[model samples]
Every structure is written in C-alpha cells, then in structure tokens.
Target chain A: MTTGNPGPTSGPVRSEFADDAEMTELVQMFVDELPERISQLNEAWNSADCQRLEHIAHQLKGASAGYGFSVVGEAAAQLEESVRQAEDNLSAATRQFDELVDLCRRATM
Target chain B: MQQQEQQPVLLLIDDSPSIHRLLGFKLKNEGLDFLAAFSGDEGLELAKSNQPSLILLDLNMPIMDGFETLHALKDDPETIEIPVIVLSGTTKPEEKVKAFELGAMDFVCKPFDIHELRVRINSAIRISRLMRMLELRAQIDGLTGLWNRAHFNERMGTELEAAQRGESEIALALCDLDKFKNLNDTFGHPAGDAVLQGFAAVLNAELRSYDIACRYGGEEFAIILPDTNLEQARSVCERVRVKISERVWPNYPKLSATASFGLTHIGADGRTDASAFVDAADTALYAAKEGGRNQVKVYSELPEAGDGPAKLALAS
Candidate 1:
C-alpha cells in the first residue's frame, strides 16, 4: 500500500458508483479527466516541483475515493506521504509519484 | 436584528475543482445553499460578503494554505464568529490539533463518510444558529422589539468611527415623546405602554430599511442613519414625527401623541467622539422641545454662540 503499486491480479479500477445508474455521467467525467491529472503529475515531477506534486497528490487523495476510485486515492495518499516525508531523499518520492500516475492511467468509468 | 429564516448557506473553500464538483453533487439534497471558492483569497472575500452558516476549508491550498486562511478568518471581526470545519487529506493527529487550535469547529480526514459528514455539518450549523440567536436576543429590547440602549451605544460608536474615516456619512437623531409624563399620569401605565409600542411601530414604518431605530430609554428613542446627510436625516425624522402625531389609540379615542426630534449630521471631516456626537443631537432636541412640542431641529441650524438670541424655526 505504501508503494502504491497495483497488484498483478488487479484489473482496470472502476468507481464504486460504476453500477449506480444515477452517477454514470459524473463518474464518467471523473474518469475522463484522468489523462489530464496524469500529465499534471508528470509535469510536477519532471520540473522537480515537489510542492506542486504534493498538492496535486493531496487533491487526488481527497477526491478519488468519492468518485469510487479507492485504488487511485490510496496511491495518491502514498505519494503525498512520501513527498511530505521525503526531506533530502527524492528517489523514494519519485517512485511513489510514478506509481500514482500509473494508477490514474488505469482508472475507468 | 431579526433575520428572516432562509436556507442555510454552506461554503466550501478548496483549491481542487474535483472536490468542489463532487461535494456540489453529493450535498445537493442536504437542504443548503452551496457556495464554492477555489482559492483562500476568494474564500475570505466570499465569507465576509455572504456570512455563510458553515465553512468547509481544505488544508492544502497553494499560496494561502488552510492554516494561514484559518488564522486570517479568526483574526477578522467580520468572519471571526463563523464556524469552520477543516478537511485534510492527511490523517496526522498533529494537523487535527493545529486545526482546533486555529479555531476550527471540527476536523474531517479525507475519504470522510458521507453520512458522518452530514451529521457533523448539521450539528455545527444548529449550534452556530443557536449562538447567533442568543447573541441577537441579548442586544434587542423585549418591550418594543427594537435594539436596546446597550446595542444602540455600541452601534453609534461604530457608525461614528466609520463616518470619521471617510467611509460614509452618518446622522443621529434623539427623539423624546413630548409631555410623556402627563400621558402616564392621566392615562395610567398601561396606556403609556401602548403609546410607546405605537410610537415604535411608527418609527419602524417610516424609517428606511438601513436606518436603525432603537429604544434609548423610557419615552425616548434613538435613530442611526448611515450614508445620510443633514437634509435626508431631517426629512426622515419629520416623517416619523408626523406619523406619531397622526396615530390614534383605539382603546383611548381622545389620545394623541407627538415626539420632538434633534438631528445631527457627521461628514468625513467631523472629529467628534460618541458623547459629543450624541450631545449635539440632544441640544437640537432641546431646541425642538423649546420651540414647539412637535418639530424637527437640525444641529447646524442652531445659532452660533454669543451671536444673538436663539433664532429657532417654529413648526407651522
């Protein structure tokens, strides 16, 4: 869970509202924004903007679970924690950041 | 200051658009008027203008993070009393403690249970509303339902300060029921009470919406007119005077009441304390009483000292 790496048996992650007919459009909107969020995560990491990276991860951690993407939320939480505690060690935080981006890529409606 | 009951407003301050969208959808049926702000600066502005019942503040904003924003909110007189619930993505106990120290009413970690959040929000709004009601009750007069003398004193000082600061023009008027003692002795206490109540109603009806009318004491009242000059205030007081004189008590058909008013205006250059401001209006009121029982007298119209005999305008 701390590594934020998806297990081999884990399939494309669906929202908790995947089966909720009323939430179809909202859940789809969240899923549709995944690519943008993934790009944002990469931009923050590549630019070495640890503060921005932490903010984006923090937002995802708070928002993903409500959209029924608990896996992505967990990944985001792990990345946020690593960045917060990283201090001078940037390697570990970089690893968690990449793992979160992968989770966002695999998120589905 | 009794406010008409309306749907409570819930303001969410968060940098994340997704969080705003999600909460907007989830809390749509929670019987609240929802407002959203994407940054702390925007949130602070909205809080001052709207005075929302409850605030949901996110802790991880970019420039003005939750702690800084919380500190600012608690510091401002306008937004200090508002209850805030801090929402943080991290589950650190220290963050929770810090939020509470900053005057947050409650703290909810990320991935909060929707049911729990609803219950917490309801309880906070209920408690805040009750507190406000209690505060309002303390400042209101029970007999006439107008602001009590204590509230009037406080408001007068605030209005004077604002006027001196060049923010707005202000006027004050002191009103006394002419020959009130005669009415009380002749008609009895109960009848006197009815006239006071009737006078209060006339004041309420005649004054503009922003004008504040207060029960200064027995048989006397005070009015604070913000953003008004001498002519406007005199006109308003004249209307109230006429209304009081025309009012007829059904229980006592022969009963008639008239009130004398002293009006004073303060502009941006006016350098006066609350006492002096009040005294100016009181002097005008004395002139009104001396000239005639029913009339309006402006402070500026009083004769200069040692100039001549007091040349006061008598009511036609």
Candidate 2:
C-alpha cells in the first residue's frame, strides 16, 4: 500500500518562484519575519486581542503566496475569516484559532 | 519615440491593510495602478472621485460591506456604469449569485491568485471600455460626426443646471445653412451632403473642445458654449460662419455654404431655464435669417422665443 506524503506548502509548493531571485529575496524576508509575526499573533490571541490577530492573519494571507508559502497564506486566510465570524463567541473560536497557529508553526518548521 | 501606455486603474475596497499591502506588492510591477480603500464608504468615495477602470470589492468588510457598497455604486448615476468584481473569502454559490444579482461583473475568491486577479481585472476593464465606446457611438451623429439631438438635449439640461449653480454666463447658438434645400434640389443631394460635411468641419475647427456642437436637425446645428458671454459667443459664431463661407465643398468645388447664426447669452445673474434658453437661441437664429441671412443675430432683439415670425421651416 502506498501513502501520499503530506505536502510542504511552506517549502517548494511551486517552483515557478524558485528561480525568481526577487521572489526568493521576499521568501527570505518572510522566513526572517515569521517568528516575530507568530509571536505577535500569540500575544494577540493570549490577550483576547481579536482585532490584532485578525489583522496579522489578514496580512499573512496577502503576503505568504507572494513569498512562495501558499499553505501559510491559506492558513492565515482561514484564521482571519474565523476571527471575523467569531467576534461574539470567543470560547468557540479558540479551537479554530489554535489549530491555525499550529498549522502556521508546522509549515514554517 | 515611445508612446506612454495608460495603465488600467483598479480600485480595491477591503478592510484589511494586509490585503492592500499584498495586492500592492504583487501588482505594483504589473503595469496597473492600484487604488486601495479600507472600507466600503471610503471605496465608494474613491470610486466616485477616481473613476477607476475596474473595482475589486471585498464582500466582507466593516460598516458598509461589499454588497451594500455595490448597491450604492450601481444606483449612483456617475458610478452605475463602472464594472465591479466581488472578492470574497467564501466560495458559497449563494454569495456569488447575490453578487451577480447586485451588478457585479465577476467574482473572485481570496486569497487571490495573482494571475487570476490580473486576468479578471483586465477582462472587466476591457468590457467597461467597450461599453463606453458603444454608448459614445449611440450619442454621436453619423453624418456630421457631431453629438446627436438627444445627447445635446441631455447635456444642455445638465450644463444649464451647472451654470445656475456656478452663476456663470453661458451662450447657446442655433445655426442654419442658407439655401440648403435649393442646393440639394439643384446640385443633387450629394452636393448638399458635401457642403454639410464641410460646414461641420469648419464648426469643429472653430469651436472649443468643451463646446457642445450638435447636428440638431437637417441643415441645422446647435452649439452650447459654457462660460462664454454674448460677445464671446458672437466671436465664435462669426469665426465658424466665416470658415463655412470660405470652405470649398468637396464635390461642388465652386459652391460655398453660408450659415446664419442665432445666439443668446444666459447672464450671470439672469434666470432663464433650459427650455427658454434653447427657444431664445432658435429665435435668434430666426432673426439671423430675417436679417438677410449669413449673419449672427442676438436673441435679445428678436421677438418672443418660439413666437418669432420666421418659422424654422422657412429659415433656409
């Protein structure tokens, strides 16, 4: 029995941008910036700063694909939407938020 | 020499600044001018002022949201014609249907693919430019290449209202080519057509770009000169008349056409409405015919508008 490997969305999901030196530069910047952004995301989540978390997620969604991290962008987008929908229900929103944060961390790793 | 290509402007209305930064970074080098609005209200304001070639509206936004903004835009006379592509995170069919029903040209799901976004933006702009060309063709006179009567009337009403608000002087002139019927009857309709074409060329050459030059009817033209006084309008009319008098008709080389002009000025303080304004101009034109033709006549001295002895039927 053959099992398909889970894809590396943060890795080389697309080789189209691999050869693009400018895009590679952006990818490097994104990799360098990820830890700081993730820290900010965690801080926002811990403090119940829904607005800040949504904002960071929104930014990540827009920028990740440009830097060759399609999965990261998708995860960010999901987080952003969830935050928007979960404005009045913080307890129910916690699981979705935590799942996306783990997904982002794993993608970067 | 390289001609500078006009880049299409895309108005993006989304609440997220991250989306703005992302789209901007992706599209900045792609030969497009990106306009960003953080909210639907801000987007609507930008749409009204900038008149972007296309709009990429986010469905989920704060306050005004995408659907509400789209409705407002479609209802507005200035922006109703602008093409909007809905950008939403949800892939729900009902959402797409609602967007379409609200006059969205296309729907895009986020996070956006740069290539897909480019394609959709280009398609929307192309459709909008084509629609504008179609509207212009409908409003233009095929024969004289001037504005048609319907367009003229609409513009006249708009200009009159604008002038009223600005308290500015404006002039309207009604001109008729002398003995046009006789030329058509004696020298054939082709000769008459050539003269009409020649006259139109002269009018175009003599009038300002902002002037509303229209083929009001057969052998008759109406011109609206905004921010022009009686004397200024007369100078323009005289110049046009002289140019028409000197132009050699294409088929009938020896024949030259002379047009009689009737002009009226709406004073800075005066209150003549649209109907009265046009009537005064037509009456002034009748007076020009009465004054042995080929001359400019002011409506201030002419009999009451629409009650002049010289019927437009016998003006030639």
Candidate 3:
C-alpha cells in the first residue's frame, strides 16, 4: 500500500521530514512519542470513552500533519469524523480507530 | 505618556503543546516576542497584561473556548483594539463566519502552511503598527512634541474619574511662559518657538516618569501628576520653574525665559468634574501671573473671597 493508505502488509512509513537536516531532531522527537500516543488511543478505545477518543483523534489530526505524517493525520481525521457521527454507526468509528492505530504503528522517523 | 516602540508580541492561545512547539520553531526567526497560553482563559489574562500586538487563538479549547475568549477580549476596553486571528482544525464555513463576526482579523486552518502564516502575521503586525503610529500622531502636539490639548482633556477626565473612585490623589498644574509675547516681540517668533521647545524639554526632564505633560495652547502647558499631593506637586513644579529660569537660549545668547505655575489638588472629597478642576487651576495661574510672573501658586491657598493673589510663599 502507499505510505498513507491503511494496509496490513504496508512497509514502514517514513516521515516527510525524515530526509530534512533541520527537522531531523524534531521529527525524531515526534516519532519517539508515537508509542505513548498509540497507548492513549488504545486506552480510550478499550474504555469505550467516545469523548476521550474523539479528543485524541482531533489532536492527532492537527498535530500529525505538522510533524510530516499526513497519513496519520488523514487517518485521525477519518476517525474523528466517524466518532463525531457515531450515533448510528459505532462500527464505522471502530473501523476508523483500528485503521488509525495501524497507521501509527507503521509511522517512522 | 509616550512609549518607545519595541518588538511586536504575538500571543498563541492553544490547548495543544504540539502547535505551540511547532509554531515556536517555525516563527523563531520572525522577530516576534512569542507568548503561549494553553487555554483561552490564560490567553485573555496575558493579552490584558502584555497587550500583545496580535493573537493566534485556537477555537477548539475547553471551558473558555476561542469564541468566549475573543468575546471577552473585545469586550474589555483595555484589550478591545488588539487584533486576533482564529486557528481551527476544521474549516467549517459557519464557524469561520462566526469567528469573523466576533471580530477576528483572519482565520487559519491547522496545520498551517508556515510561509503563508508568516506572511499573514507580518501583514497584521505591520497594519497594527501603522495604526498605532497614526493614533500617536493624532494625540501629539506637532510643534512641542508634548501631548496635544485634546488628549489632555481626555486624560484629565480619566484621571479625575480614577481620583473620584478614591484611588489616589491627583494634582493638576497649568504653566505659562512669563511674558511670552514680549520675548516674541523682542527676539522674533523663532526665538519664542525655541523657548517653548526648550521649556518642554525641561518639563520632560523635571517630571517623574508617571507624570504627563501636555501643550495646552500657545506657550501654556498642563501637567497631570497622579498619586501626588499638594506639597509633592509644588516641589515638582518648583523644579520646572527653576530649570526654565536657568536655561540659556542657544542662538539668542541674551534671551532668558521663566515660567509661572498654578497648582490644584483633588480627590480628597471626590470631586469629578474636569472643567471645574481646570477653572480652579486657572484661578491659581491667574494669581501666579499677577503675583509678579515667576512663581508657583496653589489654588487651595488662594484668598477665599476675591480673585486676589495667593499668599503662599515663593519657591526658594
């Protein structure tokens, strides 16, 4: 799959800043913090806290693009949208959350 | 009170630390004093105290959100003129309209294109700086560089209101160059202008930093001394009088000028009217001019009945 696409067999997704000399350190810091964000997402999902899930997704959607992870940002946006409209489609939100988690796992420095 | 221009301050009110970090890094070289607030409430407080030139406010904050914060900032007389730019994660048309209607100067969607954001910030700051320059020009006397009469009237009302609230003692003084017309006739108007400019310099030098000096009209000037009593005001005005009498005019080496002052104290009984207070000082000023033209006279010490000269001792 392409870098931003959610595919089970996709290779590691390199940040857009991974090649930039100036942004290397910042990009590495963002990459280092990914595990904690993933855990937070997992905790919010397992607790079935829709508000907490949407808040995290919203933050990630805004922050990921700045860190050069457009794929993660786009996934987060999709998850945020699904959760926002989850009154009748809880399954859709669940599917988006799972896709976002997979994208985060594949993200690289 | 003239303030020296400094680096423009940009306050960022956002809940996310990542946005602050990103913008802080991106805008590092933009010659801005950057301030960050994690929530809208904190941003409002900073805006009030620091008076930032521009504000970048996030619309998605919790509790006191961006809309509420913007409303509060615009509501306050102190922060109302500061320009605010709204930042949002989503570009909802209705939200954009709401933000603009609530007085936002611009709206940017996150994550920002750093270049575009920089241009927008520069343009906003430039416009604000130009506007402030224009405001200052409007209130300043063109010749003497002291505050103009209109600004003095406005400040007098404000100071009087503060005093009426029992906040502090305020003293007003009306100073006039002794025999200004004679000096103009003797050495020419240029020399008179030079003397007026020279007196303003002395006023600037003699008054405390908190004191405000204004060119009332012609060779007449007014001073507003906040948190000063009658004795304190007398000492300050005495110094101005002494300094002016001692100054030597450069081109016209033979010209020597002196000024007379009339002082009045207020807020002891919470008097609020501006004109009446001015009239009292004017009465004292008339006493100074009549009592041989080179002295400081207090309004309270003036004779109770007629327009006779005040019996207060001259400054030694």
Tell me, by TM-score, which candidate is best.
3
Full-model lDDT for every candidate? 0.86, 0.79, 0.87
**Candidate 2 clashes between residue pairs 3 or more apart in a chain or in different chains:** B262-B285
Is model 2 an incorrect, acceptable, medium or high docking prediction? Answer: acceptable
- Over B1-316, each residue of candidate 1 has an lDDT whose tens digit, in order, gives 6569999999999998888888888888989999899999999999999999999999989999999999999999999999999998878899999999999999998887777888999999999999989999998988899999999999999888877686577889999999999999988888899999999999888999999999999989999998997789989999999999999899988889999998877664556677877877888889999998799988777874123122211110
DockQ for every prediction shown: 0.67, 0.37, 0.65
Tens digits of per-residue lDDT, candidate 3, A25-103, equal: 8878888888898999999888777877888888888888898988889889989899989854467687798888988
* Per-residue error (Å), model 2, residue A91: 6.4
lDDT tens digits, residues B1-316, model 2?
1124478888989886656766777777767888989899999999999988889898877578789999999999999999999988778999999999999999988767889988888788888888978888898888888888999889998998898789888889999999999888889988888887788888888898888899999999999999988889999999998888888665676776899999887677666667877877777888889889999998775656446432331232
The alpha-carbon lDDT assigned to residue B16 of candidate 1 equals 87
Clash pairs, candidate 1, are A16-A68
Clashes counted in candidate 1 amount to: 1
Task: Give the TM-score comparing model 2 with the true structure, all chains together.
Answer: 0.80
Give the higher-DockQ candidate: 1 or 2: 1
TM-score of 1: 0.80
